[model samples]
Target: MASVRVEALTKRFGDRQVVNKVSFQVADGAFAVMLGPSGSGKTTLLRCIAGLELPDSGSVYIGDVLMDELSPRERDLSMVFQNYSLFPHMSVKANLAFPLVVRHRPRGEVEERVRRTAELLRIEQHLDKRPNQLSGGEQQRVSLGRAIIREPRAFLMDEPLSGLDAPLKLQMRAELKRVQRETKLTTIYVTHDQVEGMGLASVLGVMNEGELIQYDAPAEVYARPRNAFVAGFVGNPPASLLEAEVREENGNLELRGDGFTYRVGEDLARALKGNTDRVIIGVKPEGVKLVRAQRAPNDIDGVLDYTEDFGSTVIAHLRIGQGSISASIPPQEGIGLEAGARVGVRWDAEKLSFFDARSSERIV
Candidate 1:
């Protein structure tokens, strides 16, 4: 279960390049993830894929082998960090039999694979406790049962549940996606959160500052974001960006903004014909929906500016006429919109997205 890749992967520090030419791939057993925000080299690209940091040039395969000539335990791979480093006088069944007793195996097959990985990570009633008697999600399942008792062929992990606490990081993200799909293994997973990389990978790269901007899948990188740093970094009250202009009217391609004009749809107006005036528009906070009046294509009104319930969903914050956005409503129509209230937003010129206000790219 391997398949990682990563060409062009530069990684400097002396002259401050910190990761620049990054590339991506992660197929084999697939769980991928990466994500960003925080010095954003995403733990220096998961410490250069766990050989513990090496890339000054490129290359770091995994299934086909070339892991920069190996070491960090010959790069077979199994990392899991964010600190639950275990061993405080071991005993969660000796920390899952300390990696099958450092690979010597045979103590009755290391107590039958530590009683089947402590009953598949429920931590078998905290196996005889230690590491200060467990619980930070049982010392993160005894550091993921010492990396799933070394079944390693690949699994990297860096922000291993960033020290839990949002209901124990959502119950250790559904018990780490049910023990990575019952040991399918080939992981990767570094994180700067974004709901733990859209609730556990299966492909999503993203990264920033050091670059790798958008690898897709998690609703296609939150619906087709290819630039403007992935349409202002994947969504959730994030993609509003306005600053329109692109005219061409009679042939119909509008956009205009600062009060409102919009149209832009003959296939997004031929993908904004090289921006006749400026572009940017990107809408998505559930694609701007807070309606209760003025409706019939791209409506606009304004001044509601604030309301954030989130008990299921309610995000209003609009100021549309003077251009500012935000609208995720639906907690039964957010109990009839409030704060200053002059509402009427609408949005769906074929779900408008256009970009490139000076190379922020994606005009299609």
Candidate 2:
């Protein structure tokens, strides 16, 4: 296993800069995921690392070796693509053994490695099946087995689980996690799915518009985002952002919007003191509570717009003035609420996040 590092990596297609001055490091034996939306330069960045596409500027290194001049085959890294990239005419065993055969390993060693890889991926039963005969999930296992048999310096995966159904994707993710743990291979995975990125990564790298937004542990990225984009993108249902003005009322700072006013604590006030009057307040869906009875000092009254039931928990969409915000609540607690129902939304001042409206950067 080896560490992978990219420094000031920039790639351009025609006049468009798809990857602009990107830099990050994946520790040896750690699973790192680069996550972003489509056309956000994630796959382009991965291809640059794999030597399939050359970067316009900067460098890629594996372990202590600079790999800028190396060919894809000479890079000692295995790339598992989204399509499974299996040989249509070859059986699972043949597919797994192809890498070793190309490297001109002894016949006995190739057979042994193929068998071990098939067993590890739980595809030993399907070793004789061709790609056409295998299910989507099974074919993906063969793809993974091929990569594993190479015993490459590192692994680069580009949305390897994108083709599977939801349940199958979940199962495959668990299997992939187990394999990575046992092999301890340095892995850089590219995907647009937040759930996949958050679930698989030991280190998470968030990307947007050809820039590296944040690089950190999944929990830290979700809890303490560096900017409004990271705060909005990393969460399920996303964090709700409301436009407000910072006003010093008596001794306390208050955020005043069209239909609501939220008082701020000293810590948050101190953080926002230097900012302009215009600011954005961010609150996660879980932080927004639906209060049925008496309104508190921080409560904001709104009309319940709609509800989405997800068995154990429910998402309540509320309309506060002209803006909309969502609240994640337990079904039991939100059972009495209905569309057009008058409701009060309240959250702790400590849970609120303050951001500069113009820059969209976090102030608190």
Candidate 3:
């Protein structure tokens, strides 16, 4: 397995900059996932790394070699695309053996590698069937089998599980992780699904507007986001962002806004003292609590908007001022709170995140 690296990679189309000076490295034998919304240039970046797209600037490196002039075949990287891309007329065994066959490997060696690859992907039962005869999951496995048969230096997958049904996607996710671990393959996967990124990757890179926003372990990105966009983008329900202004009141830093005035402790005050006066108040769904009265400290009055039951938990949507907040509570705890009901919303002070309003970067 080989490490993959990109340095200040930039790509442009006509007048629009699609990938803007992006840079990151995937360690050897590491499972790295590039996650972002559509048109964020993740797939384009993967193509650049695969030598399929020439960058306008910057460099691509596999292991220790510069790969700018190398063709896709010369790079020795295998790509599993979203569409499966298996030959409809060819049987699974033939498809898996095609790479070695084209390279003029001995027929006996090709058969042996194909057999091993089929067993590794657990698709041995489907080896005699063509792509059209297989289930979606079976075809996905066959696609992976073709890549694994070549024993390439690294693997690139572009939303490989997106086409599968929800349950199949869940099943294939575990299957892919198991196959990767067994082979110890260095892999780069691109997807917009946060669940897939969190589930499969040893390292995760978040992108927005063609820029690499944050790259870290999935848990770290969730717990400590770099800015407001990341804070709002990485979580399930995401952190609620509300506008507020920092005001000095009797040696204290107070966040004052429509229908709310929150005071920060001395330690945070010292940190925000010289910074900007405006900030975006952020609260996670789990940090929110609903109350019948304004008895709790820091409680902000709000109107219940709706509730969603999830068996284990209920998410209560509340409207406080013009901003919305999602509070995760036990079903029993969320009982009686329905739309149009007035409730007091309180956020855990310790878990709150603050971002500069203008820069949208984390202040504390």
Candidate 4:
């Protein structure tokens, strides 16, 4: 296993910059996941590291070797693509053995490596089956085995589970995590799925509009985002961000919105001391409590716009003034919340996040 590092990497296409001065490092034997939306240049950044797309500037390093000029093969990395790029005509055994064979390893050694890899991926019984004959999950396992057989310096997986159904994807996710932990391979995985990224990564890098916005532990990124973009993008329902203005009401600091006003504590006030008057308040769905009765402090009355039940939990959507917000609640608590019903929305002040409206940078 080897650590992967990129320094000020920049990639551009014509007039548009696809990757802008992105820099981060994946420690040896650590799993780093790049999370972003579509068109966020995450895949392009991964391609740059794998030597599939050369960076216009800056440098990439695998262990101690600078790889700016090396070809993909010379990078000593195995890539598992989204489409499971396996040979249709080759059987599973041949596909797994192909990497070692091409390197001119002894036939016995290649067979032994292929056998071990197939067993590790739990596809040993399907060695003779061709790619076309295997199920989607099985085919993905074969692709992983092919990559594992070579035992490359690091693994680059670009949304490898995107082709599978929901249940199959979850199954493969667990399998992939198990394999990576067992081998301790330094793996960089790129995906638009926040759940997948958070579940699999020891370190998470969030990208947006061709820039690396935040890089940290998955929980840290979720709990304390560096900016408003990271705050909105990392959550499941995404944080509900409301535009507000900080005002000195009496002796206490208060955040006033169109239909809500929340008093800020001394700690929060200190964090927002130098910020502009205009601020953004971010509250995750779970942070918004749905109360049937009116409450003091941070409560805002709104009408229940809709509710979505996800078996065990329910999301109660509400319309406060002209803005829409949602609160995640237990199914039982949400049982009486009906559309157009009057409800009280309370913010969890302890979990509230404040951002500078102009710069979108987190202030508290």
Candidate 5:
């Protein structure tokens, strides 16, 4: 396994730039995932690193070798594409051995490597089966095996789990994590799925409009997003944003929204003291508490819209005044909240996030 690095990478087509000055490093044996929406240049950036598409500028480094001047073959990186891309006529064993065979390794060596890879990926029983004979999950394992047998410097996977069903995807995700941990291979994964990225990647690079918006640990990115875009994009159910006014009352700061007023924490209040009256108040679903009735300060009256049950937890959608908000409630809490039920929502002052209205950037 080896580290991978990209510096000042830029890719352009015609007058449109697909990637703009993208730069990040994948530490040795680390799983780094690049995530973004469609047309956001995530795949293009991966292709650039794999040498499938050369960049117009910037350099890529795999270990100590500079890859910008080298061909894909010379870069010695294995890539598993979105589609299985397995040779239909070849058996799983043959497909796994193809990499070593093409490199002119001895037959005994190829057989040993292929056997080991298939076993590691738990596809030993399907070695003789052709691609068409295997299930989608099995074929994905075979593709991963082919990449693994190469024993390249690093593995590049582009949305490898996109085609599998939910259960199969979950199974394969766990398997992939185990394989990566056991082999300790440097891996770069490209995906638009935030769940997949957050579950597997040790480090995540969030891209938007051809540039990386944030590069950090998954928890860090979710908890302390640098700006509104990162905050809005990284969380599940996403963070809630409300248009509110910040004001000082009796020498204490408070955030006034349509139907409620919340006292800001001392630290947060200090950060927004000199800011304009209008600011965006952001909070995660978990931060908002849905109570059966009204509470003290920081509470807002609303009518429950609907409940989304996801097994262990329920997300309550509430209409507070002219705006709507969602809160995650524990299953056993059993507020029995339903559509059109009157309710109140409250959150801790420290849980609030303050962002500038004009720039949409976090205050602190």
Candidate 6:
């Protein structure tokens, strides 16, 4: 296993900068996930690292060796594509052995690796079956086995589990994490699914437009988002954003918006150095609370819109002052708040995220 480093990598197609000066390092044996929406340049960045797409102006280093001029074959990287690119003409065993065979590995070594890879991916029972004969999940596992059997320097996976059903996605996420840890493979995976990325990544990167926005541990990216985009994009259901103006009313900081005023703590107030007048306030579902109250100094009034119950937790959707937001309500508080019933919304000050209204940068 070896670290994979990409230095100031950028790629463009004609006029559009698809991937813009991105730089990051994956430590040896680390599971790093690049997360973003489509057209955010995650796949382009991955392709650059894999030698599939040449970066306009940057370098890719596998271990200590520069690989800018190297071909895909010369790079010795295993890439598991989204489509499960397995050969229908070949059996699972043949597919797993293909990589080694192409490299002119000994027959004995090829057979041994095929068997072990099949076992590792739990596709041993399907060894004699062609890809078309197997289920989607089975074929995907075989596809992964083919990649794993190569034992390359690093594994680059582009949404390999996206085709699976919801339950299978859950199962494969566990399996993929286990395989990476058991083999200690340095892996980089790309996905648009925040839940999937959060589950599999030791290091999570959030990207937007053509730029890498924030790179950090998944927890840090969620709890301490570097900007509004990171805060809105990282969490499941994400953070709810609201427009407001910052003010120092009577020597105490406050966030005033439609029909309500929110007090800001001293710690958070100090984080704002200058230009603190206009700001956007963000609160996670878990931070916003549902209170049965008449409009108060800091309580925003709203009407219960709807709810989403997932057995373990309940999300209360409320309409507040021309805008709507969702809050994670305890089972006890979830009841009796039906649609059209007026309610009060309050936030935990420490949990609120304040961003500059103009730049959308985090202030606290």
TM-score for every candidate vs. truth?
Answer: 0.42, 0.97, 0.96, 0.97, 0.95, 0.97
Q: What lDDT tens digits, residue by residue, belong to model 3 across residues 231-270?
A: 8877778888888999998877898877788778787788
Error of 1 at 17 (Å): 26
lDDT by residue for model 4 (1-364), tens: 8999999999999988999999999999999999999999998999999999978998999997899989999999999889988998898898888888889999889988987898899998999999999999999999998988889999999999999999999999999999999999999999999989988999999999999999999989989999999988887787888898898878888888888777888988877766689898888899988878657766888899999999888988888888788788999998777789988888888777888999999887
- Evaluation by TM-score, superior candidate among 3 and 6: 6
With candidate 3 superimposed using the best TM-score fit, by how many Å does residue 353's alpha carbon deviate from the native?
1.6
lDDT of each: 0.80, 0.90, 0.89, 0.90, 0.86, 0.88
Q: Candidate 5: which stretches are off by over 4 Å?
A: none
Comparing 1 with 4 on lDDT, the higher-scoring candidate is: 4
Which lDDT tens digits does candidate 1 get at residues 61-91?
Answer: 8887788878878886888889977888868
Give model 2's TM-score versus the native structure.
0.97
Between prediction 3 and prediction 6, the one with superior lDDT is 3
- Residue 173's lDDT within candidate 4 is 92
Model 6 regions lying over 4 Å from their true place: 293-296
lDDT of 2 by residue, 244-357 (tens): 999999988998998888888777788888677988888889888888888787889899999999998899999998888888999998787878999889885656677899
Residue range 1-364, candidate 6, lDDT tens digits:
7999999999999989999999999999999999999989999999999999978999999998999999998888999989988888998888889989988999988988888888889988989988999888888888888898989999999999999999989988999999999999999999999999999999999999889998999999999888888888877688888888888889888778765677877787777635678888888889988778555577888888998887778888888777677899878788777889988888888788888989999877
Model 6 weakest lDDT span, ten residues long = 266-275
Between 3 and 5, whose TM-score is larger? Answer: 3
